[model samples]
Target: MTATKVAFTDVKWTMLVTLHMRAMDSRQAEPVLGDRFAAEAERRIDYDFGSWRMRVTEGDRHLVTLRAKRLDTWAAEFLAAHPDAVVAHLGCGLDSRWLRLAPPPTVSWFDVDLPEVVALRRELYGDAEGYRMIASSVTDPGWVEHLPTGRPLLVIAEGLLMYLTAPHVAGLLSRLTTRAPAGQVLFDAIAPWVVPTSAMLSPLLGAFRMRWALSDVREVERWGLRHRDTETLLGHHERVPSTLVRSVYGVFARVPPVRDALRAFRFDF
Candidate 1:
């Protein structure tokens, strides 16, 4: 007989990748890291759920997967430009971006997360020549000082901001911007209009053990970072094609009013 295992808060959430990978099935969602990473992520999710208490839905799965893939594409492009730079993935969770991007030998990649997540990452991926895992929350400024200076840096905070309070996120952005001489940050934010609604539904979602902390896109500017550009992801990628967008996203793409309102924004420093 199998013994019951206690659930821990430190375990990386698998629902994060479910949305994007499922969206890939429609052929409308163009995933930056391709299929292998998505498949691996799904496998990890399945493994974790088997051993722990977690819940995911078809919608949640699709959104998380698409968001991750989009961010992966953005991070890959940044790394490609600065081959010798340092790449930091804040709240790294159990992602395999280093494998997907395959940075050159010269590039240094750091995966930052809570201590528990770091332990899990070590257990799963081990260490490599240039890949390092730092067990520290991004809000902690001490980690920034340790990173190598004198080169462009690319910091990625996929699905991180939403979980943070406004002040904490602002503080983190300020610290990162000040520390890196030249670098860009790629992150997602919801518009102000969507936050209240999301918050209202949070309780119901929480009943199922799912909760969301969303951020307003406009609030990012308060961090003193330059606003670059914001792209609406639903049908933005050319590779994804229109048919897949319509089929996978369904009414999400068709409802002009809702599509306009519920869009993700990208910001830079």
Candidate 2:
């Protein structure tokens, strides 16, 4: 089979970074997400991943996988209760989340992203009986306005909000909450400090600088939803090679600011 060539650049190109991380983690004996589809997708894509392999550390890869794992856990819990629901994976990118969740036919699953990314997704994984692709920016409300609103909604915005502007995040959340009768939103936020830190250190992250930051996780409640839970992305994972390094991180994870550096938040409307 011929590999699919990707033309994504700038912010859009960053999706491949997360994809690469998940692909690498899926090879682990005890994977966090065990996203085999991501590994397969990485193999089918015709792009050089050498730079990312060199620039990103094993810990970084684990963190990426763990973040998705936590979101998956939350999403699965939500779906268990609401089997007949609408799940919109905003800024879906090339992540094989729909394949991972495998929601029932009664559940309407939509992978929402920019047209270019959606085009790539179409080639990688075509639409199914209950799954469809929406080619539009998550910040733009027009596309989301038409989503099925009769059932419970689950909006998964994994690594999306940070790239959007403050107003865009609020507007998107507002529009989403207003559409569904009741549902949940799963997303991760980086502290303001992470933005400048990434700019100074990592070229890959500097390419698409994170524009939005949430110092307080409770801020989302002000937008439209009630805060359900918050989890810090730091701490030692089984994949981290060094025990000493893991212990050091475990200690730092106790600090409020350090813990908030990157966090997963859940909210219900």
Candidate 3:
């Protein structure tokens, strides 16, 4: 008997972008977020990572891992405050974030993604005691109803929002803040300049179609969230441990205007 291979199609194929990055990080001499599971899992699947060069370039190959590292840091801090937190990792791909984070046994972790992606996840990793594999689109209103109420909830959307409409992201924030007593949301987004045109045509963006771009994450503060924190992610000075990538991106960061071109933002309510 042989194991079934992962077959994510259409928009679901976008998940591979992150998958490729993790696999590459594992191969790095100094992996920023060296996800071991990603390396092992990538081997099991027949996905041709070598051919994905059009998308994950030499520099971007490093940036994707950095984004994951920062998001993981934020998630860890949130869990520290609410050990029994309810986490919804929207657009959860093949990356082993839940297992790596290893939240306290009391925490309830939900890995949410499209039905196809969810099926693949269950097939590969199955489910843990407090872990749930949710098969549904993140934009679906019904998904929110399934979450436990009156608990500290942390919603993580990595490499997800830019693929969705602006209204959808806003609606999601509104839902989470209103549904959970204490809540936090962490996500990454493209800068505005890259949004309207340049990024959509960039070879690096590849299969990803940028629908929303926020050069300044503070602009999203107008979405009506009472509290928010935004940080420069791709900029050289911020958390980018790779000296090579820092030197490359640091040039743009020095421009000041490109400070938050690509960023990770956290909103608390």
Candidate 4:
């Protein structure tokens, strides 16, 4: 059946991409994340995703789960120290991350996203105590106001930041760094110079042209947060898929210029 119940708008439509990626991961021979909850959530969506062709090879598949898997790993580590840490999942799609990551019982997790996206997520996943679905853009100055205070916080931005304007992203970075003061943040992106041509090459991002892209990981240091990695997050993983991607990444990672095809950074304030 075709989707007629709702139409995804602007950045909200991007959520389906992550949902589809997770669904694809579940079907892999050796799934990276193995998020069964993601597969189930994809099933519950009435939207028809039969024609979207983003991941065309095993290499693409490995990259998809790598972003998510890294974020999940970081979350686990943060929660291990501060079992009651507040997790802010910005631009959270139909990810079921709280369900998949399974943070501690005392952990406070917030799924912050667009109004339409949050509404859809509520329908798909329902409401749970300590887990919230905040309906607002991550750029909002007051977005930080909704999160719990006086607790260790970990902000997971996953595929966000790039789509926003420079000022918007700057404002958000300032807000996050100031509001939380001390915590971790996980966000991934290609360099600004590359992002202009990225959409043309990747069929998935072809339609949605991102608004802003930063060229360097060090740029974020201006926001008072330290960039944790110089290399791409995909390369440092323990269990990289034994595909041509590994070979390509192995060689490309040797270079200083082209190594950061997709840069992942964890920030410490």
Candidate 5:
């Protein structure tokens, strides 16, 4: 069988990095987010991922999987409460979240991303009864129109917000929050310090730059949505590369600034 060619460039190419992270975890004996689909996708793709092998450290994969697990938990919880929910995964990339979650037919799921990315996804996994793919920039307000309304909506924006500017982020939130009757927006964000810290990863990041940062959750509240909760990946009692680093993290995790360096937030409209 011929492998699918992936020629995504610029920000679109970063999707492979996240996909690779999940694929790496899936290969683990005991994975955090056991996503076999991601592993298979990695094997099926023709692109050479050797360049990212060293770039994506253990800590990076750990944090990313943990963050995704948290969101997956929240999404399942939301679906339990509102079985007829509308979930729009912005900047969907090649992540097999829809397949992993496996929501019931009552729930409407949409995987949204760029045209090239969506095209590749369609080739990988075709459309289903309640699942659809939208090829458009998440930054574009018009894309929101494609989503069905009058049901509880859950917007999942993993590894997406940081790439957009403050205004773009605000506009996106406004569009999602205003349209949906009531629902939550789940996303991970880095603190202001982490924005500059991304510079250390210049080679891995390519041409993309981290634009937005969240100092506090309250800042999002000012945008009209009420803050639901905030969780930091650092505070989680999980295995790290070294016991000494875990010990130090346990100590510094108490510090608000250190804890908030990278966090996952949920806000209800």
Candidate 6:
């Protein structure tokens, strides 16, 4: 495998933390990951050498687990509906969603991310029978042309939107929608207020960097995506306790009603 050209930074570290969180959930769901992945994930947590130290925030961890479960459910349903569907996970990082979903042999899954991230993933997980990895920035429309455009595509952007600016995200969405005639995209978003503040304070959260270039859900609709659903992820998921949600989001919760103006939003498009 080629050495990763991507430098370790807070933004990239955040993805690693999220991936570890999901791997932990997989261990909890089914011992499929067994001791190996779990132990490796634990070691990553222990070393704490990354840009952002992986702190298991109760609410954030809870939300990560809940979202993993929900994504698995959605992937299973999508596979069942379109047995031959093509699923693309944008900015996949080191996530093993394919392993978690275990979609049938007929399902074709593509894990797409930056070249460096993809290189690191290949070293860590390698490719499977029906799974492939594309090393390219999501903003590049060229990658979409390589996918099986004939089949319906289920595109997933988990915890990726907030990092990109609105125009770049909008362009990516437009390209995907146009490239794949009919498809659904599931992604998470935060209110406009959270974007600027998070961007400013991101450096403090370890090397876990964040940049919020987008604000409105309506802007996504402008790119030809229809809003399908919005749900509070952590506590509302039932999997996570309300207390945990309050604890994790409590900082945000403490924000005066004026600050409440900065609530996050999840959209299915």
Best by lDDT: 5
How accurate locally is residue 144 in candidate 3, as Cα lDDT from 0 to 100? 82
Off by over 4 Å in 3: 1-3, 7-9, 52-58, 198-206, 215-219, 236-243
**Each prediction's whole-model lDDT (CA):** 0.62, 0.84, 0.77, 0.74, 0.85, 0.64
Can you rank all candidates by TM-score, best first?
A: 2, 5, 3, 4, 6, 1
Per-residue CA lDDT of candidate 5, range 100-187, in tens?
Answer: 9899999999999998999889888889999999999998779889888889999999989998899999989999888788999999
CA deviation > 4 Å runs, candidate 2: 52-54, 57-59, 201-204, 235-245
lDDT of 3 by residue, 1-269 (tens): 35456555545666776777787778877678888888777677766666654344444766678788889999999999999899999989887999879999899899988788887787778888889988888889888888898899999998888888889988987887788887788998887676666445555454566788765546567775544666666553444556766776777777655766678889887
- TM-score for every candidate vs. truth? 0.76, 0.92, 0.89, 0.86, 0.92, 0.77
Worst 10 residues of 1 by lDDT: 2-11
Better of 3 and 4 by TM-score: 3
Error of 1 at 196 (Å): 3.2
Q: Candidate 1 regions off by >4 Å? A: 1-6, 10-33, 41-56, 201-204, 207-218, 236-245, 248-250, 254-257, 260-265
Q: How many clashing residue pairs are found in candidate 1?
A: 6
Please give, for residues 127-148, the per-residue lDDT of candidate 4 as tens digits.
7777888999887778788877
lDDT for position 179 in model 6? 60
* Model 5, TM vs. native: 0.92
CA shift at 235, candidate 4, in angstroms? Answer: 1.4
Model 2, backbone clash pairs (residues 3+ apart or across chains), number: 0
Residue 83 of model 4 has an lDDT of 88
Error (Å) of candidate 6 at residue 115 is 2.0
Error of 3 at 19 (Å): 0.9
Clash count of each predicted structure: 6, 0, 1, 0, 0, 6
RMSD of model 4, in Å?
Answer: 3.0
The prediction achieving the highest TM-score against the true structure is 2
| Clashing pairs for predicted structure model 2, backbone only | none
- lDDT, candidate 2, 200-264, per-residue tens: 75565565577899887567878878888888877534445446656766777888788778889
